[model samples]
Target: MTQPIIKLNPHLFFGGNCREAMEFYKSVFGGELVLTLYGEGPPDAHKDPKANSEEMKSKVMFAKLSGVITLLASDNPNNTEAENTGQFGLSLEGSDESIFKGYFDKLAEKGQITAPLIKQFWGDTFGMVTDLYGVNWMVNITANRD
Candidate 1:
Protein backbone atom coordinates (compact mmCIF):
# COMPACT_ATOMS: atom_id res chain seq x y z
CA MET A 1 0.00 0.00 0.00
CA THR A 2 1.21 3.51 -0.78
CA GLN A 3 0.76 6.39 1.56
CA PRO A 4 -1.44 9.12 0.13
CA ILE A 5 -0.23 12.69 0.04
CA ILE A 6 -2.31 14.93 2.29
CA LYS A 7 -2.57 18.65 2.53
CA LEU A 8 -4.89 20.99 4.43
CA ASN A 9 -6.87 23.63 2.59
CA PRO A 10 -9.14 26.02 4.43
CA HIS A 11 -12.70 26.13 3.15
CA LEU A 12 -14.95 29.06 4.03
CA PHE A 13 -18.73 29.36 3.76
CA PHE A 14 -20.32 32.74 3.24
CA GLY A 15 -23.88 33.97 2.86
CA GLY A 16 -24.21 35.05 -0.78
CA ASN A 17 -21.10 37.25 -0.71
CA CYS A 18 -18.56 34.65 -1.71
CA ARG A 19 -17.92 36.12 -5.16
CA GLU A 20 -17.13 39.56 -3.83
CA ALA A 21 -14.93 38.09 -1.14
CA MET A 22 -13.10 35.89 -3.63
CA GLU A 23 -12.43 38.86 -5.92
CA PHE A 24 -10.96 40.76 -3.02
CA TYR A 25 -8.72 37.81 -2.27
CA LYS A 26 -7.64 37.56 -5.92
CA SER A 27 -6.52 41.17 -5.80
CA VAL A 28 -4.61 40.65 -2.61
CA PHE A 29 -3.07 37.25 -3.36
CA GLY A 30 -2.65 37.54 -7.15
CA GLY A 31 -4.03 34.12 -7.99
CA GLU A 32 -6.05 32.47 -10.69
CA LEU A 33 -9.66 32.70 -9.58
CA VAL A 34 -11.85 29.81 -10.64
CA LEU A 35 -15.42 30.47 -9.59
CA THR A 36 -18.71 28.67 -10.11
CA LEU A 37 -22.15 30.02 -9.34
CA TYR A 38 -25.16 28.19 -7.99
CA GLY A 39 -26.71 28.22 -11.43
CA GLU A 40 -23.55 26.66 -12.80
CA GLY A 41 -23.13 24.05 -10.12
CA PRO A 42 -24.11 20.40 -10.33
CA PRO A 43 -27.62 19.22 -11.06
CA ASP A 44 -28.38 18.89 -7.36
CA ALA A 45 -27.66 22.56 -6.81
CA HIS A 46 -30.15 23.51 -9.49
CA LYS A 47 -32.62 20.84 -8.43
CA ASP A 48 -33.15 22.29 -4.96
CA PRO A 49 -36.64 23.78 -5.05
CA LYS A 50 -35.82 25.94 -2.06
CA ALA A 51 -32.75 27.37 -3.77
CA ASN A 52 -33.30 30.70 -5.45
CA SER A 53 -31.40 29.93 -8.62
CA GLU A 54 -32.19 33.19 -10.40
CA GLU A 55 -31.26 35.47 -7.52
CA MET A 56 -28.20 33.42 -6.62
CA LYS A 57 -27.02 32.85 -10.13
CA SER A 58 -24.25 35.38 -9.62
CA LYS A 59 -23.41 34.23 -6.13
CA VAL A 60 -20.37 32.00 -5.74
CA MET A 61 -21.27 28.34 -5.34
CA PHE A 62 -17.61 27.34 -5.25
CA ALA A 63 -14.44 29.37 -5.66
CA LYS A 64 -10.76 28.59 -5.69
CA LEU A 65 -7.74 30.86 -5.66
CA SER A 66 -4.80 28.82 -6.86
CA GLY A 67 -1.21 30.06 -6.70
CA VAL A 68 1.52 29.67 -4.15
CA ILE A 69 -1.28 28.39 -1.96
CA THR A 70 -4.81 27.34 -2.72
CA LEU A 71 -7.82 28.86 -0.95
CA LEU A 72 -11.33 27.54 -1.38
CA ALA A 73 -14.72 29.00 -0.48
CA SER A 74 -18.39 28.64 -1.25
CA ASP A 75 -21.76 30.18 -0.52
CA ASN A 76 -23.76 28.73 2.32
CA PRO A 77 -26.88 26.87 1.22
CA ASN A 78 -28.84 28.04 4.27
CA ASN A 79 -28.06 31.71 3.55
CA THR A 80 -27.43 32.16 7.27
CA GLU A 81 -24.68 34.31 8.75
CA ALA A 82 -21.72 32.91 10.55
CA GLU A 83 -22.48 32.51 14.21
CA ASN A 84 -19.01 33.44 15.39
CA THR A 85 -15.88 34.98 13.89
CA GLY A 86 -13.63 32.79 15.96
CA GLN A 87 -14.82 29.58 14.34
CA PHE A 88 -11.39 29.13 12.77
CA GLY A 89 -8.38 30.97 11.41
CA LEU A 90 -5.85 30.20 8.69
CA SER A 91 -2.28 30.06 9.89
CA LEU A 92 0.45 30.92 7.39
CA GLU A 93 4.05 29.98 7.93
CA GLY A 94 6.83 30.77 5.54
CA SER A 95 10.59 30.59 5.41
CA ASP A 96 11.11 34.23 4.50
CA GLU A 97 10.43 36.59 7.41
CA SER A 98 9.98 39.62 5.20
CA ILE A 99 7.51 37.85 2.96
CA PHE A 100 5.55 36.60 5.92
CA LYS A 101 5.38 40.10 7.38
CA GLY A 102 4.34 41.47 4.02
CA TYR A 103 1.43 39.09 3.87
CA PHE A 104 0.45 40.07 7.41
CA ASP A 105 0.48 43.75 6.50
CA LYS A 106 -1.59 43.18 3.38
CA LEU A 107 -4.15 41.12 5.28
CA ALA A 108 -4.43 43.77 7.97
CA GLU A 109 -5.33 46.54 5.55
CA LYS A 110 -8.78 47.86 6.55
CA GLY A 111 -8.96 45.04 9.10
CA GLN A 112 -8.41 44.64 12.81
CA ILE A 113 -5.04 43.51 14.03
CA THR A 114 -5.51 41.35 17.10
CA ALA A 115 -1.76 41.11 17.56
CA PRO A 116 0.95 43.08 15.87
CA LEU A 117 3.83 41.25 14.23
CA ILE A 118 6.53 40.79 16.80
CA LYS A 119 9.02 38.32 18.13
CA GLN A 120 7.34 35.53 20.00
CA PHE A 121 8.57 33.32 22.86
CA TRP A 122 9.40 30.66 20.34
CA GLY A 123 11.72 33.16 18.62
CA ASP A 124 9.52 33.54 15.56
CA THR A 125 7.83 36.62 14.24
CA PHE A 126 4.11 36.13 14.68
CA GLY A 127 0.90 38.11 14.41
CA MET A 128 -2.85 37.61 14.26
CA VAL A 129 -5.40 39.64 12.35
CA THR A 130 -8.96 39.52 11.10
CA ASP A 131 -8.93 40.51 7.44
CA LEU A 132 -11.41 42.59 5.49
CA TYR A 133 -13.09 39.39 4.34
CA GLY A 134 -13.91 38.61 7.99
CA VAL A 135 -11.42 35.77 7.91
CA ASN A 136 -8.86 35.41 10.68
CA TRP A 137 -5.19 34.97 9.76
CA MET A 138 -2.14 34.05 11.73
CA VAL A 139 1.22 34.76 10.08
CA ASN A 140 4.39 33.32 11.48
CA ILE A 141 8.01 33.00 10.39
CA THR A 142 9.99 30.17 11.75
CA ALA A 143 12.98 30.86 13.97
CA ASN A 144 16.33 31.30 12.26
CA ARG A 145 18.67 28.72 13.68
CA ASP A 146 21.60 29.85 11.57
Candidate 2:
Protein backbone atom coordinates (compact mmCIF):
# COMPACT_ATOMS: atom_id res chain seq x y z
CA MET A 1 0.00 0.00 0.00
CA THR A 2 1.18 3.48 -0.78
CA GLN A 3 1.33 6.14 1.92
CA PRO A 4 -1.27 8.82 1.47
CA ILE A 5 -0.11 12.42 1.21
CA ILE A 6 -1.24 14.68 4.00
CA LYS A 7 -1.77 18.42 4.14
CA LEU A 8 -2.22 20.26 7.41
CA ASN A 9 -4.17 23.54 7.38
CA PRO A 10 -4.78 25.94 10.23
CA HIS A 11 -8.38 26.39 11.36
CA LEU A 12 -8.99 29.41 13.55
CA PHE A 13 -12.01 30.13 15.72
CA PHE A 14 -13.44 33.61 16.17
CA GLY A 15 -16.08 34.99 18.46
CA GLY A 16 -18.77 36.29 16.07
CA ASN A 17 -16.13 37.97 13.95
CA CYS A 18 -14.99 35.20 11.64
CA ARG A 19 -16.29 37.05 8.61
CA GLU A 20 -14.41 40.23 9.42
CA ALA A 21 -11.22 38.39 10.22
CA MET A 22 -11.41 36.33 7.08
CA GLU A 23 -12.01 39.47 5.07
CA PHE A 24 -8.96 41.05 6.61
CA TYR A 25 -6.88 38.03 5.74
CA LYS A 26 -8.18 38.20 2.18
CA SER A 27 -7.02 41.78 1.97
CA VAL A 28 -3.59 40.90 3.28
CA PHE A 29 -3.05 37.75 1.26
CA GLY A 30 -5.08 38.68 -1.83
CA GLY A 31 -7.08 35.50 -1.63
CA GLU A 32 -10.50 34.27 -2.66
CA LEU A 33 -12.85 34.35 0.29
CA VAL A 34 -15.67 31.90 0.81
CA LEU A 35 -18.03 32.23 3.74
CA THR A 36 -21.10 30.39 4.93
CA LEU A 37 -23.29 31.95 7.55
CA TYR A 38 -25.01 29.91 10.22
CA GLY A 39 -28.38 30.73 8.72
CA GLU A 40 -27.27 29.79 5.28
CA GLY A 41 -26.89 26.16 6.19
CA PRO A 42 -29.73 23.74 5.80
CA PRO A 43 -32.44 24.13 8.44
CA ASP A 44 -31.85 20.60 9.65
CA ALA A 45 -28.13 20.99 9.82
CA HIS A 46 -28.07 23.01 13.02
CA LYS A 47 -29.33 21.24 16.10
CA ASP A 48 -29.13 24.19 18.48
CA PRO A 49 -32.23 26.36 18.90
CA LYS A 50 -30.16 29.52 19.30
CA ALA A 51 -28.52 28.88 15.93
CA ASN A 52 -31.66 30.29 14.36
CA SER A 53 -31.39 33.58 16.18
CA GLU A 54 -30.66 36.56 13.90
CA GLU A 55 -27.41 37.31 15.64
CA MET A 56 -26.20 33.73 15.51
CA LYS A 57 -27.45 33.32 11.98
CA SER A 58 -25.39 36.26 10.85
CA LYS A 59 -22.22 34.78 12.26
CA VAL A 60 -19.87 32.97 9.98
CA MET A 61 -20.21 29.21 10.19
CA PHE A 62 -17.36 28.61 7.83
CA ALA A 63 -14.81 30.76 6.09
CA LYS A 64 -11.95 29.91 3.76
CA LEU A 65 -9.37 32.20 2.21
CA SER A 66 -7.30 30.56 -0.49
CA GLY A 67 -4.28 32.24 -2.03
CA VAL A 68 -0.54 31.87 -1.63
CA ILE A 69 -1.59 30.40 1.68
CA THR A 70 -4.92 28.85 2.64
CA LEU A 71 -6.66 29.74 5.87
CA LEU A 72 -9.84 28.33 7.32
CA ALA A 73 -11.84 29.87 10.13
CA SER A 74 -15.28 29.88 11.70
CA ASP A 75 -17.22 31.69 14.40
CA ASN A 76 -17.59 29.76 17.62
CA PRO A 77 -21.20 28.86 18.20
CA ASN A 78 -20.79 29.28 21.95
CA ASN A 79 -19.41 32.81 21.44
CA THR A 80 -16.46 32.20 23.67
CA GLU A 81 -13.86 34.93 23.84
CA ALA A 82 -10.77 34.22 21.78
CA GLU A 83 -7.60 33.88 23.78
CA ASN A 84 -3.95 33.49 22.96
CA THR A 85 -2.45 30.70 25.01
CA GLY A 86 1.00 31.25 23.52
CA GLN A 87 1.08 27.57 22.71
CA PHE A 88 1.55 27.95 19.01
CA GLY A 89 1.93 30.47 16.19
CA LEU A 90 1.73 30.35 12.42
CA SER A 91 5.12 30.68 10.80
CA LEU A 92 5.84 32.04 7.34
CA GLU A 93 9.30 31.41 5.94
CA GLY A 94 10.70 32.16 2.53
CA SER A 95 13.66 33.64 0.73
CA ASP A 96 11.83 36.69 -0.57
CA GLU A 97 12.80 39.42 1.88
CA SER A 98 10.58 42.18 0.50
CA ILE A 99 7.42 40.09 0.35
CA PHE A 100 7.84 38.62 3.80
CA LYS A 101 8.76 42.03 5.25
CA GLY A 102 5.63 43.48 3.70
CA TYR A 103 3.56 40.78 5.35
CA PHE A 104 5.24 41.38 8.68
CA ASP A 105 4.52 45.10 8.49
CA LYS A 106 0.90 44.71 7.44
CA LEU A 107 0.21 42.16 10.12
CA ALA A 108 1.65 44.50 12.72
CA GLU A 109 -0.86 47.23 11.97
CA LYS A 110 -2.85 47.94 15.12
CA GLY A 111 -1.13 44.94 16.65
CA GLN A 112 1.77 44.43 18.99
CA ILE A 113 5.20 43.59 17.70
CA THR A 114 6.74 40.89 19.81
CA ALA A 115 9.99 41.07 17.88
CA PRO A 116 11.23 43.45 15.25
CA LEU A 117 12.36 41.93 11.98
CA ILE A 118 16.13 41.95 12.11
CA LYS A 119 19.10 39.85 11.13
CA GLN A 120 19.81 37.12 13.59
CA PHE A 121 22.95 35.16 14.38
CA TRP A 122 21.50 32.41 12.20
CA GLY A 123 21.87 34.88 9.32
CA ASP A 124 18.16 35.22 8.65
CA THR A 125 15.72 38.04 9.22
CA PHE A 126 13.05 37.08 11.74
CA GLY A 127 10.24 38.76 13.62
CA MET A 128 7.06 38.06 15.52
CA VAL A 129 3.79 39.92 15.74
CA THR A 130 0.40 39.47 17.25
CA ASP A 131 -2.23 40.64 14.83
CA LEU A 132 -5.25 42.69 15.78
CA TYR A 133 -7.21 39.46 15.94
CA GLY A 134 -4.84 38.14 18.57
CA VAL A 135 -3.30 35.63 16.24
CA ASN A 136 0.45 35.23 16.52
CA TRP A 137 2.57 35.11 13.41
CA MET A 138 6.28 34.57 12.79
CA VAL A 139 8.03 35.76 9.67
CA ASN A 140 11.45 34.50 8.60
CA ILE A 141 13.36 35.54 5.54
CA THR A 142 15.99 32.91 4.92
CA ALA A 143 19.44 33.98 3.87
CA ASN A 144 21.29 32.14 1.13
CA ARG A 145 23.40 29.69 3.04
CA ASP A 146 25.52 28.79 0.05
Candidate 3:
Protein backbone atom coordinates (compact mmCIF):
# COMPACT_ATOMS: atom_id res chain seq x y z
CA MET A 1 0.00 0.00 0.00
CA THR A 2 1.07 3.60 -0.67
CA GLN A 3 0.60 6.44 1.79
CA PRO A 4 -0.52 9.92 0.87
CA ILE A 5 2.10 12.65 0.80
CA ILE A 6 1.90 15.19 3.57
CA LYS A 7 3.84 18.40 4.13
CA LEU A 8 3.71 20.76 7.12
CA ASN A 9 4.45 24.45 6.73
CA PRO A 10 4.80 27.05 9.41
CA HIS A 11 2.62 30.15 9.20
CA LEU A 12 3.46 33.20 11.32
CA PHE A 13 1.61 36.42 12.11
CA PHE A 14 3.38 39.71 12.71
CA GLY A 15 2.32 43.14 13.90
CA GLY A 16 3.06 45.24 10.78
CA ASN A 17 6.51 43.66 10.47
CA CYS A 18 5.75 40.73 8.26
CA ARG A 19 7.68 42.10 5.32
CA GLU A 20 10.81 42.77 7.35
CA ALA A 21 10.70 39.42 9.04
CA MET A 22 10.02 37.51 5.85
CA GLU A 23 12.81 39.35 4.07
CA PHE A 24 15.19 38.38 6.84
CA TYR A 25 14.23 34.76 6.46
CA LYS A 26 14.84 34.96 2.74
CA SER A 27 18.32 36.27 3.39
CA VAL A 28 18.98 33.41 5.75
CA PHE A 29 17.39 30.60 3.74
CA GLY A 30 18.04 32.02 0.24
CA GLY A 31 14.55 31.38 -1.09
CA GLU A 32 12.10 32.99 -3.48
CA LEU A 33 10.12 35.55 -1.55
CA VAL A 34 6.66 36.63 -2.60
CA LEU A 35 4.78 39.33 -0.79
CA THR A 36 1.26 40.55 -1.41
CA LEU A 37 0.39 43.91 0.09
CA TYR A 38 -3.00 44.67 1.56
CA GLY A 39 -3.54 47.37 -1.03
CA GLU A 40 -3.30 44.78 -3.77
CA GLY A 41 -6.51 43.16 -2.58
CA PRO A 42 -10.03 44.21 -3.55
CA PRO A 43 -11.10 47.58 -2.18
CA ASP A 44 -14.24 46.23 -0.53
CA ALA A 45 -12.64 43.10 0.74
CA HIS A 46 -12.48 44.45 4.26
CA LYS A 47 -15.54 45.91 5.97
CA ASP A 48 -13.50 47.97 8.44
CA PRO A 49 -12.59 51.44 7.20
CA LYS A 50 -9.30 51.31 9.07
CA ALA A 51 -8.29 48.32 6.99
CA ASN A 52 -8.44 50.57 3.95
CA SER A 53 -6.11 53.15 5.38
CA GLU A 54 -2.69 53.78 3.79
CA GLU A 55 -0.91 52.17 6.71
CA MET A 56 -2.96 49.05 6.43
CA LYS A 57 -2.62 49.04 2.68
CA SER A 58 1.17 49.04 2.98
CA LYS A 59 1.07 46.12 5.38
CA VAL A 60 1.80 42.62 4.15
CA MET A 61 -1.40 40.78 3.36
CA PHE A 62 0.55 37.64 2.64
CA ALA A 63 4.20 36.62 2.43
CA LYS A 64 5.72 33.35 1.31
CA LEU A 65 9.28 32.08 1.15
CA SER A 66 9.93 28.94 -0.85
CA GLY A 67 13.29 27.25 -1.31
CA VAL A 68 15.26 25.25 1.21
CA ILE A 69 12.07 25.53 3.23
CA THR A 70 8.57 26.89 2.79
CA LEU A 71 7.44 29.63 5.17
CA LEU A 72 4.25 31.63 5.15
CA ALA A 73 3.43 34.76 7.12
CA SER A 74 1.22 37.84 7.18
CA ASP A 75 0.61 41.02 9.10
CA ASN A 76 -2.25 41.17 11.55
CA PRO A 77 -4.62 43.87 10.39
CA ASN A 78 -6.82 43.51 13.46
CA ASN A 79 -4.00 44.64 15.79
CA THR A 80 -4.45 41.60 17.95
CA GLU A 81 -1.77 40.55 20.46
CA ALA A 82 -0.38 37.60 18.57
CA GLU A 83 2.90 36.14 19.82
CA ASN A 84 4.87 32.90 19.61
CA THR A 85 5.76 32.93 23.31
CA GLY A 86 7.44 29.50 23.31
CA GLN A 87 4.23 27.67 22.49
CA PHE A 88 5.88 25.81 19.61
CA GLY A 89 9.02 25.80 17.52
CA LEU A 90 9.99 24.88 13.97
CA SER A 91 12.22 21.80 13.92
CA LEU A 92 14.74 20.96 11.21
CA GLU A 93 16.47 17.57 10.97
CA GLY A 94 18.80 16.22 8.37
CA SER A 95 22.06 14.29 7.83
CA ASP A 96 24.15 17.29 6.78
CA GLU A 97 25.79 18.67 9.91
CA SER A 98 27.47 21.62 8.22
CA ILE A 99 24.30 22.82 6.56
CA PHE A 100 22.22 22.59 9.72
CA LYS A 101 24.98 24.21 11.78
CA GLY A 102 25.23 27.06 9.33
CA TYR A 103 21.51 27.62 9.65
CA PHE A 104 21.75 27.59 13.43
CA ASP A 105 24.56 30.16 13.46
CA LYS A 106 22.82 32.48 11.03
CA LEU A 107 19.58 32.28 12.98
CA ALA A 108 21.41 33.08 16.22
CA GLU A 109 22.94 36.32 14.90
CA LYS A 110 20.74 38.87 16.69
CA GLY A 111 18.81 36.16 18.53
CA GLN A 112 19.39 34.21 21.70
CA ILE A 113 20.61 30.65 21.72
CA THR A 114 18.55 28.59 24.13
CA ALA A 115 20.83 25.62 23.52
CA PRO A 116 24.20 25.34 21.91
CA LEU A 117 24.66 23.04 18.97
CA ILE A 118 26.76 20.12 20.11
CA LYS A 119 27.08 16.38 19.76
CA GLN A 120 24.45 14.87 21.99
CA PHE A 121 24.46 11.54 23.76
CA TRP A 122 21.97 10.31 21.20
CA GLY A 123 24.73 10.70 18.57
CA ASP A 124 23.51 13.82 16.78
CA THR A 125 24.23 17.52 16.73
CA PHE A 126 21.28 19.41 18.26
CA GLY A 127 20.57 23.00 19.18
CA MET A 128 17.81 25.56 19.59
CA VAL A 129 17.51 29.25 18.91
CA THR A 130 14.87 31.93 19.03
CA ASP A 131 15.27 34.27 16.10
CA LEU A 132 15.06 38.05 16.18
CA TYR A 133 11.35 37.82 15.40
CA GLY A 134 10.73 35.71 18.48
CA VAL A 135 10.34 32.56 16.44
CA ASN A 136 11.83 29.46 17.96
CA TRP A 137 13.79 26.97 15.85
CA MET A 138 15.39 23.62 16.50
CA VAL A 139 18.02 21.94 14.35
CA ASN A 140 19.16 18.36 14.59
CA ILE A 141 21.85 16.80 12.42
CA THR A 142 21.19 13.11 12.62
CA ALA A 143 23.97 10.58 12.72
CA ASN A 144 24.04 7.45 10.61
CA ARG A 145 22.37 4.62 12.49
CA ASP A 146 24.24 2.00 10.48
Count of backbone clashes for each model? Answer: 0, 0, 0
Cα error of candidate 3 at position 7, Å: 1.8
How accurate locally, in lDDT, is each candidate? 0.80, 0.86, 0.88
Worst 10 residues of 2 by lDDT: 78-87
Estimate, for each residue in 1-146, the C-alpha lDDT of model 1 and write its tens digit. 99999988888888777887778777777879999877775555555554555666667778999987889998876764543356789899987987788788888988889999999898988899998768999898999789
Sorting all predicted structures by lDDT, with the top scorer first, yields 3, 2, 1
**What 10-residue stretch in candidate 3 is worst by lDDT?**
78-87
Query: Candidate 3, 35: how far from true, in Å?
Result: 0.4
User: Per-residue lDDT tens digits of candidate 3, residues 1-146?
Assistant: 99999988898888888898899998888989999998998886878776777878899888999999999998887773445546789999999878888889999999999999999999998999999888999999999899
Give the C-alpha lDDT of model 1: 0.80
Positional deviation of 89 in candidate 2, in angstroms? 0.8
Candidate 3 scores a C-alpha RMSD against the true structure in Å of 2.0
> Which candidate ranks first by TM-score, i.e. highest?
2
Mark the regions of model 3 whose C-alpha exceeds 4 Å error after superposition: 47-50, 80-85
The C-alpha RMSD of each candidate to the native structure, in angstroms, is 2.2, 1.8, 2.0
TM-score of 1: 0.87
